[model samples]
Target: MGTKPPSPWDRHPSRSRPERAHRERPTDSNASMHADHKRELRLYGLNAVRAVFARRPEAIRKVYLNEARIPQLQALLKWCAVHRIGYRVVEDADLQKLAASSHHEGVVADVLREPAQSLLTWLQALSSDRHCALWLDGVGNPHNLGAILRSAAHFGVAAILLPQHSSLALSGAAARVAEGGAEAVPFVQLGESVEAIAQLHAAGFALAATVVAGGEDVFAAELPRRLVYVLGAEGEGMDRGLAADCDLRLSIVGSGAVESLNVASATAVLLAEWSRRGA
Candidate 1:
């Protein structure tokens, strides 16, 4: 008889018999670590870490730093030791790994994530007639958010309002960029846009939609004593329906060389004008 044809299974034994290859499943410790990571926020940068320690030292779960940072962080380390919090004095490479960024500034802290406050609670607490807040309609860039927080803190903004279903959350990179402003500003989670608008109206606050063009000049306009500037995301801009519902619309009126200032830069100008008027 002619040589028997080789079976296809013989040519691909590994595929035919999958059980021959052993795959290791994640251990319980690995799974637990992942769950812990989800519950914690990795705050890096010297100022960012210091701010968390200053504001909520109890929230800090652990810390990692290079030897060079020890002198500057002696107080923090002492607090950590006293509280029995875990800390590691590792090399630069380990610090980078823990921070997930090279800009860790030689220190990193794992702390419990600060939860956003409800709109109703925040509104109830706002007794000041001369107060300002930001309604970030869709500004999701971390760097932009950080810059905005820094400006907001500098201008004494009351809060940062997040719309329903907003993906914006404080992150390590954003906190680092904020340079401790993250600790100064509180994020308020909003409900439905229309309902939230009504609530603000009831609280004697006016909403101003920031547009690229076809709006009152921000410099000359009479901004409300209690106002919320609705800033949109880059490129796509704010929702048209939301913009239409705003009490007023304002434009920065910059030189036509570029379309407009960055959202963060525009916020600084707007806040400055408001502060100047209130001053």
Candidate 2:
């Protein structure tokens, strides 16, 4: 039997980082944040910035890199030129203040925001046969969000759904922890869980709520083709009403010592299992 040849990405594991492509600076501009670009957030670190450059160069509104990192960020600067995006070099100290931390790896960006679609519009848009997305009920820690997104992208989950009122938002810390997953995966804001779950049911997704008990072992059962894995914060777990709305409840089996897994950790496990089941 002949199988299709895999794409370069299929062969290249998602964990590997691409080395920076070098180039020279062209006409430059200041690194000031504009009111029009208020929607844009600053992203830092080499991998995170590189991911933005690779995935969507147009999103980058401005570039600020340390003078010493000029060579390392040449590709980004050249991109700024070709894209007519503005950029400027700053001392490493300026970078610290701009990034509000010393972990920026001498690079930051005012990445533009894409207009968000309504939840109905988003659900209408996903007409694919197999649909898998992560829904957060109350999870808001940026680092955990990033970790979940990293795993979600790695295993080919379609999107990350956050409630509109959730405290989660795109920040440099989250983007940096995602290590480019932020650029790779789609993020959507959902409204009330009841309303959203009803729409999901109409869309034909198997709503599986991850819980401490009253759920099946994902490793043992066959997952549906179209599934929505609803997970929540470590302590609170999913909202009771939301959990009741799910078609199935799923749990990860462990050694029975710890009461539960962190939301991000459990998400990675479930996503891995979802892929393993060939869903």
Candidate 3:
């Protein structure tokens, strides 16, 4: 008999299936890179996604989803339909890679906001509002900043200001922690928080800072007509210049066993007390 023709699968002795690209391989790396370069972040988490929809629906360039996340995706789609926002479906792995972490929970949002602007202009615009501001002197960590932001929004602060070079803008990690507050609150970037405090002083706002030593007790200090509380970095506290600019250096009184409080914790205490003063 003539040699049997080889089956397609068995045709090549050493041939094997080509490795498939992972489902999460980013097809839009260039696009994502552009977003990163522009200081925009790819965000996930249900609340974070909801916040973006509620606050800046137009800011979202796209929304990606996986089959597993369809329930949440449906809700988002409903909202997007109402708002006229566009979105797409993708594999779960793609979202994980886009988020750059596994915490994405199968949903990712491409955010676009006006490039960060000076806190001064925002402060100037809010010049007439009867509200307070929080100046993060040098809080370097995004978690601390995001936590503080959540507290700020809940307590009704007008805005939160950070130093220009302090760290990245509201990141995905921050958005996750803030639980939607990140979008609700306006984050302003300033040249130097110390210099910003000076302008705040000139603008007739009371500037209070947290210090471990030689500062008035937070409970005892008389908050001003308009208040701006300055909380230092978690480890370094406030810079000397920033500390000096404060109208009053206030300290949260706690058990002496602990050397100091986390900057975010200190801020929550001060904001709570300040809010209580209003009530």
Candidate 4:
């Protein structure tokens, strides 16, 4: 048969993807924090802000958009007006300042961040036997995180499990890149890795460590009914100890031209395979 057509999960092998106009760096400084003791998040881009308005209108504290975007955001503006929420029509410069990014796409909003769910709470609420989640070991890039969230939402992933003390919270750039997926998936904070692993096992989840090489082919392996794909940091890869503790190790068999796919791309491929297997 001829080469199969590329699916949505397919990515070009070239590493020439265009970089964003600005980098969204994470910081604990006060300048990075939003209102209400940093409980709020500044979400920019049309889809990011619009998703917040559509899903949780009351959480939107303020909105700033250019005059040109008014027609597109009529419903959001009307909702703001009805709720007495402050919204301003300003120049693109002002919008950039408000969003702290040049790629704000003419709109921005400050919305209260949804609190993370406890692992036990999420586990208790999981009603489906066939479900998948991502246990992000050290994946910290906001854009990558956003891409993962988008894929997770597309594949019906149950949650993004964050390890205790992991500084990887959703950023504005991540949310913007997610394109409304941020509202669809929930993030669960995990406790100790040992305890978390045990809890996941008890909840009928098999933790599979995604490795660069020397692991079972993910495409051919029998996936668990309930699974958690453990993804690691970009450069360092997964912690050796954690990988050893995992129930199984899996690798995405790719052309050897490159070392491996980025965490986000790999996640999409893995999730697609898992979803294809009817997980």
The per-prediction CA RMSD against the true structure, in angstroms, equals 14.0, 11.0, 10.6, 12.3
lDDT of 4 by residue, 132-171 (tens): 9999989999999999999998999999999898999999
Which pairs clash inside model 3? 24-93
Name the lDDT of candidate 4.
0.87
Give each model's whole-structure lDDT. 0.87, 0.78, 0.73, 0.87
Question: Could you tell me every candidate's TM-score relative to the true structure?
Answer: 0.87, 0.82, 0.78, 0.86
Cand. 3 Cα-lDDT: 0.73
Rank the candidate models, highest TM-score first: 1, 4, 2, 3
**Candidate 3 segments exceeding 4 Å error:** 1-39, 78-94, 127-129, 192-195
In model 4, which regions exceed 4 Å deviation? 1-37
Model 2 scores a C-alpha lDDT of 0.78
What would the per-residue lDDT of candidate 3 be over residues 119-192, giving only the tens digit for each residue?
A: 66876677565578887777778788779879998999988877767764778877877888887778778785
Deviation from native of the Cα of residue 59 in model 1, angstroms? 0.8
The residue pairs that clash in candidate 1, if any, are none
Residue 279 CA displacement from its true place in model 3, Å: 1.2
Q: Is candidate 1 or 4 superior in lDDT? A: 1
Encode model 2's per-residue lDDT on 137-244: one tens digit a residue: 888888898898789889888877877687667789888888888877787888877788778788888889899876898888668898999897768787887788
State the TM-score for model 3. 0.78
lDDT of 4 at 268: 97
